[model samples]
Target: MKSVLQIGKKILLVLMIIAVIIAGTRSIGMGMNIRTPKNGINVSFYVDINGSNQWINIYGKDIDNPVLLYLHGGPGSATSPIDYSFTRKWSDVYTVVTWDQRNVGKSFDKKNAADKITKDIMLADGKAMTEYIMKYMGKKKITLLGHSWGSMFGANLVLEYPQYYDAFIGTGQCVDIAENEERLYEEAKKWTEGDEEGKVLLSKWSPDKCDDTQALLARSEIMNRYGYGMMKDGRDYNIVATILFNPNYLVKDYISYVKNIETSMEPYMDFFAHGLYECSLLGKYDYKVPYYNINGDMDYQTNYEMACEYFEKVNAPDKKMYVMKGGTHGLLESRSEEFSGYVHDIAKRMASMK
Candidate 1:
């Protein structure tokens, strides 16, 4: 009887150990691993602005060619890893500068407050960072490529300081405030009503009282899944999301860094989310920059049609619209080959005049 009891305890301990190992492995695997581009030089720096320091990345082949300072979406999104995947291809031709805006990623911020992380603060930090990058690289001008929320900031930068950028390219651009919210609401509604699964899933979305918090949780169901259908071929989002969530080489490092960031300063993440959720109302400004708007055929996040309409009215001498056949904003990394090709063409065309 004593021997049997001992044997049972040993088996239980072994099972418990196995369960812990499995759980630990899964927890480590959950973070996204975004890859940096190849052959390009990765540059990092801290820019001091109003007693605060911000971090920026520059993906350039060499100091001789033109450079595009790439502004990432998510006022707080870190573009260092994913921007490298596609921009490195353009490095042979032009330099690409990617940065984590104030209170984001590697930028310094002991406390994250939404009020302090306003668009004005971001633009100010971006301008300071841009000036620092230009001075550091010994370059006069750079092309500006802003994705989603980045476009919002880029727009303000160009309008306020048009002479700073040589040319501008906006991906997943957000132009009108009211229209975008309506589009998102409608998309969610359609997704919820279209399928029984979607209906059951989004049953929590009370259109009348759904705030940003409610919308955030429900976003995965409507945007993540329905995004698959809106893609040019229905599989683009899947491929991109997969890569963002589970990258081969860059995933582990990126996640480790992200975990450090989150653990060290959780308020930063909260501030970022708050800014993204509430900053849509700041989109009523007029633009005065020469720009190109790039849209994926299947992107429903901000509605391609609305973007097209705004581009048509944009007041710039050198502006056009470029569409990816079956791409989404997330494709910037997942579809690196195609994305690199697009950047190459744009760089070549811009370089021709120089």
Candidate 2:
């Protein structure tokens, strides 16, 4: 009887150990398997920026044709392994370069990042990445497409280094920091009032309680539940989930190309808390660049009005604003036939100028 009991205990211990190993592997395996499109051109990516060696994923065929060096949103959101989303279709027209900025994605080893992140370090990184892309591809000029946080960086990049880009496209353009905060607060208010779960969650979103990461994440989840409603069919969470996580990001790419919110999970969360708040990347507005501002009127994140205000006020040699009707921030749908056409039209105009 004693031997049998001991044997049973030992077996149970083995099972528990096996379970833990599986759980541990799964936890670290999220982005480990993600791959760049096999057929796409892969650049010999390297950059010495902010004391970190950054990696680059150069997609598409035509390096000579105006490359759209896509700066992704997260002060840290990466571009590689997920290049399929933002650079599709444009790939045929332009050699799209997706840069995984320092401290994000597979770019610069995290060990290089110090105790605090600064806008200077971030901007220096962007400048270095841009210089590297131009030198690597041997392209004298390229277009800059900045999405969300990417847009913020795009604005600053062009302001500081207008000589590099032939044109600039700002999607989900965040020109005002206070406005974004208000937009988020309002969204939170609406969700709390209408969404029962949101109300339950936000009730606990007090600063004191949300001081920690876990509490803050719970608050963000509640906000996303309400925010995702901006999608057309409404309950496309599975499709949305796939948009963010699936390995084959062809559809995800299309979705991101059209709609702008399908961000990788970690960057999305970190940027929201630290980058958005700490990065002094907005509110100045007064700038000059060949700028085309695109916004989905239904975009709640940056709010269409704020983008328009920048277009109205900012001094630019060539400035145009296109408001996609019925389009939310992530307005990449075939249904937005006019919107897609407009993009092609703008590209043609720029190409013609080139």
Candidate 3:
């Protein structure tokens, strides 16, 4: 019996070793397959902003294609690494540029640098970055695409400097954030109506009492738990798979991605709670350039109803609203091909106007 037990233990250890090797090999293999556009423009470099370095990745099937500067969500989150899975296809028709905003993702620095990370500072950085890209590509203007928190930033930028952009595209657009939060809070309560555990968890805070960032975060946590914020189907996109396999991001970048969230959350939370509410541009609907609001029908995070209402009221040179059939906050990732196609068509229309 002792001999048999020893043999079984040896077999189990060998299997464990094999599993580790397989996982390692798969990770390396995926990294090796990281792809860039073939016969297209692909540029990855650091740009100086306020004496600090921030990363930008530009990819396109042809350098002559319309420039699309994508501002990712998560005031702290960087979407460049994961963008490879979906936005890469847009390179065929648009020069897709993904930037790591100040003090986030590849741009995060321990020193905190020349300027504090604030809405105005970020807007200035964005404007500077847009000018740089325009000069580099020899284009007078580029299209601006913003997602989630990015929408807020992009809205302000386009409104402030409409001459620099041909069009403004917003997905998961934020409109009157405080109002959206209230709606989200009510939605969360409604979802947890009969569930004892959900009720207990949600009972900790109310929207009326959620004045600070921590309380807002607590409310968001509960909402997300019931598929109100992120995954409506109770299954999150294996974002880990994208992060782990993305070749553009090294092991250090992955670590920074997480650390930056914590770093950015403190300063950015107030903006979400009060600043956005006080200074929201939802009512300022007149825009100089073409405006497009592309959103998921099921997106509760930003409140689809609010986006539509804003879209209807917003007057621009040209404007349109598209509701992604059954998408959620992750509409871009969930419906990449369709969304890209829509943008491509919009680009063509914008070119005709030019």
Give the per-residue lDDT of model 2 (tens digit) for 1-354.
Answer: 999999999999999999898656544443543434445464535677757886665666544456787777655555454444445557666777767776555553535544245566667877887787788778877788887788887888888878887888888788765566566666677767856877777765643441256665665566467653234423222343434453433444444433432332444354455555554445555455578877887676666777886778777677788778756655543233454465676788776664
Please identify which of the two predictions, 1 or 3, would achieve the higher lDDT against the true structure. 3
lDDT of each: 0.63, 0.63, 0.78
Worst ten-residue run, lDDT, model 3?
Answer: 228-237
Q: Give the CA lDDT, 0 to 100, for residue 301 in model 2.
A: 60
Give a tens-digit lDDT track for model 1, residues 1-354: 999999999999999999898656544543322224455455566677656766666656566777788887764566554454465566787777767666656663554423355656666776877777778778776678888778767777777677677888878786644566567677667766758877765665544332345554665456667754323243223444443443222456466556655443344345444544444524433455557777776666556777777777666756668888767656565566676677777777666656
Clashes of each: 3, 8, 0
Instruction: Choose 1 or 2, whichever is better by TM-score.
Output: 1
lDDT of 3: 0.78
Give the backbone clash total of model 1.
3
RMSD over all Cα atoms, model 1: 6.5
Candidate 2 has a TM-score of 0.70
User: Worst ten-residue run, lDDT, model 1?
Assistant: 228-237
lDDT of 3 by residue, 151-193 (tens): 9889989999998998999999888777877787788878888
